[model samples]
Target chain A: MRHILRETWSGLKRNRAMAFAVMVTMWVSLSLFGVSVLVAEQVDVMKGRWYDKIEISVFLCTKVHGGATDLSANTCEPGQETTPAQRELIQTRLEANPDVQEVLYESKGERFADFQEAYKNSPIKDTFTAEDMQDSFRIKLKDPEQYEGVMNEAVTLPGVQAVQDLHQVLDPLFAALNALVWGARGLAALLIFAAAVQIANTIKLSAFTRRKELGIMRLVGASNSYITLPFVLESLAAAVGAIICSGLTVAALVKFVVIDRAKPFIDTLAWIGWDAAWVAILWIAVTGVALGVIPPLLSTRRYLNV
Target chain B: MITFDDVTAVYPGQPQPALHRVNAEIEKGEFVFLIGSSGSGKSTFMRLIRHEQRPTSGKVYVAGKVLSNLRQWKVPEFRRQIGTVFQDFRLLPGKTVFENVAFAMQVLGKRTSEIKEAVPEVLELVGLTGLEGRRPDEMSGGEQQRVAIARAIINRPKILLADEPTGNLDPATSVGIMRLLDRINRRGATVVMATHDANVVDQMRRRVIELVQGELVRDQQRGVYGAE
Candidate 1:
């Protein structure tokens, strides 16, 4: 066993160039794999934040629907604009529900101010007045997925003009983020495949170089595992070295790049924590070792057939 | 210890068989010489016993086990009981003499104590004592061959094969190597040597098996070279 390890170590040292090539490829692939894990975790954190904060905004009657003078098709209905009685009754019903966590009421003036801030430096800023705007009840649910039941009940309420979910506003963004995560993972898969191939190539070279020794080993009654062990160990060592390197690279990425440098760009995003980083490192390292062992184990089959 | 019953080996991509309808048997404690011209199936015969090549037409039995029916995975265990030496010395180029000899035992999963004991004993037997640190490139042809011999015999295999073991040696060194083989045979191991050296064959006058164009043309007990 000592000889096998020593042989692998010396062979790796002797073929430093080849070993370096294999290590470089492994490092790049595993780091990208790490990056993809981080990206997925970051997206999930952001999704959780957004989902937790999402509310069903039930808008009251606006000027266009409530300001009509006539009592015809264009006229205001008896309860077109929300009255105190209607709002009190609906608020009582919402508060009575088990899934309703909290409900916040926003007056027209407050909504107008928010519109002004949202449309700041734009031509549509002062064109809208508080009187013309609609008031709303932002309904927070115990579970974000339980919004549908609230929306169904709130839509039929008196003076409720529209039922708007914050999830609608954020769905496209999450979709785009998911696409990016899958893209990163796809590229990682290809790079890891290239790494596997490069490992096989380097192992084949090592096997070919040590073939003379292998023949002698075979004739001397060396077991098949003993014959293929050096090559497998060389590959595994290189892979493990690269895995640790890539793990460090990922740690630096999460610590220095994501949480630090990407803060301003990702201001609203919930930064991925160190727990996720460590998980990614552990996952990539284990995967890298397995990936490293498989290729050479296959490639050295014929060489050890002696 | 060995039997080739009408064995014929035909390699792929070659029309003519390497050995056709050949038969021979070698008993234990026998030192037999296989004499043939180049391509006369002498190497094939060695490969047959080594299980490197399966006979195309017949069965080969060694120690009562059939070679052709040998399972692929079990070949190593079978070869473990046999020692093979070649003309090129086949010593690992960069390893020291001690490492070269110890390698034979090491590959077989020998205990460290076993290697530590047996390597020196075999090295001493091959007259490689105190030169254990010398690499193959630093040694002469004879020293290199002796290291190969030491490695081959460290297992004390039941059968020792020498395919022109002294093909590249001086007359004096050849005589010495032959004496070593004779001593090994006298110790009750079967030794089958294939050689083209007329002087060594006639001089030893051991059991001789001759092949001509893949045909077993001669088998004589205590025979000289080419004696009908």
Candidate 2:
């Protein structure tokens, strides 16, 4: 064991430059891989948090400028406003629908209050009153993905002026975040492949240089594993180095970018925690070690021929 | 002990077999010379004994184990009983003489204490007592060959195969190397050497196996190098 380790250490020392190249390549590629994992987790967290809150807002007929506006303009006559009976009927239909998980009534005053709170910093915040706001039904669906059926029905209702599925507002945001995740993952995959090839090349070169020693070892009756172990260990050492580097890099990214910078400013959305960071590091470590060990193991068998 | 039974060996991408239907046997502790011109399958015969090259047909038995039947994984274990010395004195260039000799035992996973004890004794036997710190390039051709011999014998292998151990040395130095190999043979390791050194072979007057174009032309006991 000591002999093997000494051989491995000497092999690394002899080819330190090539070994460093392999480590750096693995570090960069694995960092990207780790970041992609974290990003994927972030996308999932965002999807969960925001998707849970998504609801269909059905704006009912409202009296504006002494004429019915919104859904009333399409469903009701020009001067027709939503009657109390029509509002009650719409509420009962939404509540009875199997896809509708819950229906909450928001009166004009409540809508106006929400608008005021949302746009408090605007100059026209005080200009809007209860009469200017539309009464609405916020419908939470049993399955948010089933919104299209509820939305189409809500739009044609007697009182509803507009049916807005919140998913439409959130889908593109999620799509962009998902694209970022896949893009990073794809690039990381490419870099990891390149790192594997580089490791193979390094192993090939190292084997070529030390072929005389290998021949001597073989002639001296060393087993195949005995002859191949040092090369494998050299690559594994580089991989371990890369894993630690990538792990720290990913942790720093999570700490500085996600936690320190983004979390403080964007506290409304949950960011990835250290648990997710650890998961990503675990992925990087596994990938890094595999990348480090496999290439050399395969190439040495070919090049050493022992 | 080594035995070759109707062995024929053809290397890849070659038209002619390197060795063809060669039959010979050497008992334990015999110093045998394999004399032939280039391409006479002398090296191939040695390789067969070491299981480096398997016979294309028939069998090669080294210490009662069939060369052709030896599994790929077991070849190393089989080769442990046979030591090999090449013409180039295949030593690690960067390692010192002591390291070169100890490396053989090291590869076999010998304990450090055993290696420490055996390496110096073998070095002293090879007449390289105090040159332990010198690398191969720092030594003369004869000294380098001695180091190679020391490495080959350090494990106390039952069979020592030397393919032109003194091929690069002058006649005087070659005589010295022959004497060392004779001493080793006297110590009960079967030594098979392939060489074109007529002077050494004629002086030693040991068993000689001669090959001609992969055919066994002669196997003479106490034979001279024969009329060239």
Candidate 3:
């Protein structure tokens, strides 16, 4: 056991440059892997926070006074007003829909107040008043993804001027975030492959340099495992160093980037915490150790041959 | 004891066999000299005995075990019973004489007490007692070869195979190494040495096996270097 340790130390020292290269490669790759995992977790958290609050708005036809023509009108005819009986019929139909979880009547005054608050800093708020706003039914769906069916049926309702699904506004943003997740994951995979190749090269070079000592060991009746243990240990040591580096990098990213910077600015969405970072780090550590140990074990078996 | 029954060894990618249909045997407690010119298969003979190479067609029996049938994992354990020495004196350049000798026993997973006891005794036998602290570069060529011999015999192997053990030594130093090998032979281990030196061969007056172009041309009891 002592001899194996001594051999491993000397082997690592002799190939310190290549060992450092292996560690750097593994560290960078594992860090990228952890970041990708965290990004995926962040996407999931954003989905959970935003999808639960998504609503569908059904705009009722409104009266236009003095024969005014609204060129931007959708389902509403120019100068047409929805009667109270038509409004009640529209609400009754919406409530009967199985996909609708809840229906709340929103008056024009309430919509106008919300519009004013949302565009408080814009000059556009001056041209909009309670009379210009459309009265609507704001709906919560059993599943946000089922908005298409509810939206289609609401457009066909008697007094509905237009049907708007809020989730449409969030689709592009989620698409971009999902793309980033896959991009990071793909890049991490490529870098991990490069790290494995580098590890194999380092082990082969170390074995070549120590061929003489290995030959002597074989002649002295040293077992194959005895000859291979040092190289495996050297690779495992490099992997351990990379695991620590990547774990700390992932933790710092979660703390500084997500928790410290993003969470406060985007307070509406819940961000991933240290637990997610730890989960990512655990994955990176497992991958790092596999990359560190398996390649050297296989390479030494090929190159040493004794 | 070793026996070669019509053994033929052909290295990969080479059309010519290194050893072709050669047969010989040497009993225990015997010191035999393998004398041949370069490429006469002397080194291949030593490699066969040490289980480094298997016979291409025939069988090589060492101490009652057929070497061709030895499994890969058992090769190390099988080799512990047969010590090997090379012409270049394959010692670790940075290690002291004692460490080099002790390394042999260490590879076999011998206990510290056993290694601590046997290393000194083997060094004394090889006449390297006072030079235990000196590294290989600090020693003369003869001393380096003595360290190699000491390492080989430290495990008390049943057979010691030396391939041109004194190839790099001067004539006077070669005699000193031959004397040390003769002392080892007298200690009940079979010794097989391959050499090109005619003086050592003629002076030793031991069993000689001569190979000419991968074929055994002569096997004589109490033979000299040449046919005459």
Candidate order (TM-score) = 2, 1, 3
Residue A172 error, candidate 3, Å:
3.6
How many residue pairs clash in each candidate at the backbone level?
0, 1, 0
Query: 2 or 3: which has the higher DockQ?
Result: 2
- What lDDT score belongs to each candidate, Candidate 1 first? 0.86, 0.88, 0.89
* Shift of residue A77 alpha carbon in model 3, Å: 12
CA lDDT of B44 in candidate 1?
96
- Candidate numbers sorted by DockQ from highest down: 1, 2, 3
TM-score for chain B of each model, two decimals? 0.97, 0.97, 0.97
For all predictions in the order shown, the interface RMSD in Å is: 1.1, 1.4, 1.4
Provide DockQ values for all models, in the order shown.
Answer: 0.59, 0.56, 0.54
Candidate 2 segments whose C-alpha is farther than 4 A from its true place: A58-101, A106-137, A141-163
For residues B45-157, write the lDDT of model 3, one tens digit per residue: 98898887888999999999998889888988888888888899989998999899998877777888999899889888989888999999999999999999999999889
For candidate 1, write residues B127-228 as lDDT tens digits: 889999999999888888889888889999999999998899988889888888888888778999999898899889999999988999999998888775
| Each prediction's fraction of true contacts recovered | 0.67, 0.70, 0.65
Candidate 2 lDDT tens digits, B31-84: 999999999999889878877767899898889887777888898888789888
